[model samples]
Target: MDLLSDSALMLKVKSGDNHTLGLLYERYKKRLFGFFFQMCKDASLCEDLVQNVFIRVLKYKHTYTEESNFLSWIFKIARNVYYDHFKAAAKNKASDVDELYDLKSSDNVEKEMEQNEKMMLLKKAISKLPDDKKEIILLSKIKGLKHKEIGEVINCSEGNARTRVHRALNDLKDIYLTLEKR
Candidate 1:
């Protein structure tokens, strides 16, 4: 079923339909897990967070409003889960070693090594940006989110999201130039 039709299924879920909820979980599991994996840079942690997000959704299903965008609401919950995990990790002084590895695998390790080098340079450039700009860039460019969707995720206006993405691209270009000079 299409995403719009999923709203009807969600309504069923709200009214205590276990089968509809299971279907919804099956539909979203992979995408939501991928989002968590990227954000956490840890497969195990991503799995845990994904479970927690769905658990929270099921527990609080009564609070979900028909006026809200379903995917956006789900993502917001995922985002909050990510932030909570980050806060807890920081408190515990945990290190994320998985962040150092590329998520993709290739047949040629040499070519992958070259790509990783470039990625490290790009990551350094991204690190130079202010948090807001970096977030917009990551969501828009890397995650392939629309400006409006990103605006919703970041709690900004669409125009603001567009402006920040534009500026972030310019900043990234400048950083690339600096790296080229070095």
Candidate 2:
């Protein structure tokens, strides 16, 4: 299959082309997995969430419009999937340990330890943010979505999205600093 834009791939998927959906999955699985893992801290549940996003895409293919940003649309579905899971899991009191992604081997164990410590603190700081701030930070910084795309995902105006991201980052910095001092 030729390399197509995400929208083109989804347009094909909209027309009942299952192969295109697989292509989309291959393109986005890691990103979706990372996003969910960061939010939920569970490898197995994040994997399930990634699969659920694809299932949702297939189920709601008809709702995708040519003008819609695929990143925003897909992430919005992912966000809903996560929130739905969170609600159910909350009712069940489910929680789990932090999921580790494959880390490149370092020649220096001390350096690796320091890096891991910083990462742990950052994750804790992110977790401390309000849900809206956390979602904005995840969408803007972690997922690399532009404010315009984030606005679509968050259902806000572009300017509002930009402001939200700025606030979230500032809040993150404050939280990280506070945690670093601990």
- Best prediction by TM-score: 2
lDDT string, candidate 2, 1-182, tens digits: 58999999999999989778988999999999988876767789899999999999999999999998899999999999989987876543223224443345566789787897788777667667777787777788745589888888878899999999899899999999999998
Q: Assess the local accuracy of residue 166 in candidate 2 as a C-alpha lDDT between 0 and 100.
A: 92
| Model 2 lowest lDDT segment of ten | 92-101
What are the per-residue Cα lDDT tens digits for candidate 1 across 73-150? 677777777777777765432333346644576667898878876776776665555544655665675343678877
Model 2 residue 111 lDDT score: 78
Q: Of the candidates shown, which would achieve the greatest lDDT relative to the real structure?
A: 2
Write down the TM-score of every candidate: 0.71, 0.80
For model 2 the local lDDT of residue 32 reads 90
Q: CA lDDT of each candidate?
A: 0.71, 0.84
The true-structure Cα RMSD of candidate 1 reads 4.5
CA lDDT of 71 in candidate 2?
92
Q: Which pairs clash (backbone N, Cα, C closer than 3 Å) in model 2?
A: none
